[model samples]
Target: MEKLKVDGVSVSFGDNEVLRDVSLTLMPGELVSILGVSGVGKTTLFNVISGLIRPSAGRVLLDGQDVTGSPGRISYMLQKDMLLPYRTIEDNCALPLLIRGESKRTAREAVREKLPEFGLQGVGRKWPAQLSGGMRQRAALLRTYLFSKDVALLDEPFSALDTLTKSSMHRWYLDIMDKIKLSTLFITHDMDEAILLSDRICLLTGRPGTISREIVITEPRPRDGDFALTEEFLEYKRLVKEELGA
Candidate 1:
């Protein structure tokens, strides 16, 4: 596992700045969430970290090596699953391996063995349209894991799922994350989701968004379904709301 650091980063498009002096560290095996309202540059910050957009200043470091402006160093999953409609689920999940020059036979074999763990056993032959929203996300996440085992950048991955489906996904994700040893830095507007899933929550605020505060969740992982109803959870939510000026 590798540590990801966004050090003193800033981004600007012409005279309009999107982010400024943003710095955060994603420790190995840690799940960190960046929370803010729309248009606050959460996604912009992610792009900087993922090296899709080079920050105007500062640097992105992975395991102590500078990787700013470089793509493919870390796995990135957006809001949509982005699975090709014509491809079978297995083919979609095996894309990372294929891109790395793995033979078709080898990639397929690897996906088959790993499918059950992501709760998509025997569905590899099906198309993306055949799966439910939650199932598609599981496949997407598994694909992300295959790309880079060390770290993943998720952008509201479960936002589209219904309440029940999202709840189920939350539990399943936490369980598999431990087994897979994948650290994550995800962006979410949902305070509840942030509190439930994050080891620490970075509250991005102000125009030209910055890390205004980082709220840590002290409760242990694998929290029960009722954890959200607890006072501690509510308190965390309150803190975030206050920070975001909600």
Candidate 2:
């Protein structure tokens, strides 16, 4: 069954419409990417999905139950890692569980047990400022996962990293997702990043942003090093380019 579904959603600020008939679905354990130009309400769509903004129309459903405008139902990581410098990595990652009212010790213990699984072993007691950008991102992702193991919404979480770091993060994220099986829906403007990480890409275009196409990346997952250099990658880019141009 589809884990999360956005059904014909629309959003507007006063008379200016920001989204129109936007809709998509994330199946269990699937990683989906939403691609669009800046200021096309890509973030707005996320706000709606995360229940920070109510859609002007349409329903947000999780596992077939309508959950529109309800916060805390799914995890969300903004563009920045947003880690707290003063807090220990373990403390930072435990914020979600803490918010759910878990005792501090229990939260830390839960975070500690998953640290290695998240490629974050031995860093729990360290400050966020002491970690590298990639490490911080992993910590942020761990925090996000703590919110809801079933689903997450990531907004350009790797965009700020150096090329090598971002590439490394992608590989690490894929491996971790394989083990955790979290359903992810992320927004990114980078074509290569989208193609490299997503099972399917939703192209959002138009003055009032809407899905222009749903392009499946059929090359398969845990993609190899050469996958990016392959004709298949170029083909996906070409298709996205054409759809954006149309």
Query: What stretches of model 1 exceed 4 Å from their correct place?
Result: none
Q: Which digits, one per residue and each the tens of the lDDT, describe model 1 over residues 77-121?
A: 877999999999999999999999999999999899999999998
lDDT by residue (tens digit), candidate 2, 80-171: 89998889999999999999999999999999999999889999999999999999999999999998888989999999999999998889
- How many backbone clashes are present in model 2? 0
The alpha-carbon lDDT assigned to residue 104 of candidate 2 equals 98
Which pairs clash (backbone N, Cα, C closer than 3 Å) in model 2?
A: none
Off by over 4 Å in 2: none
What TM-score number comes out for model 2? 0.98
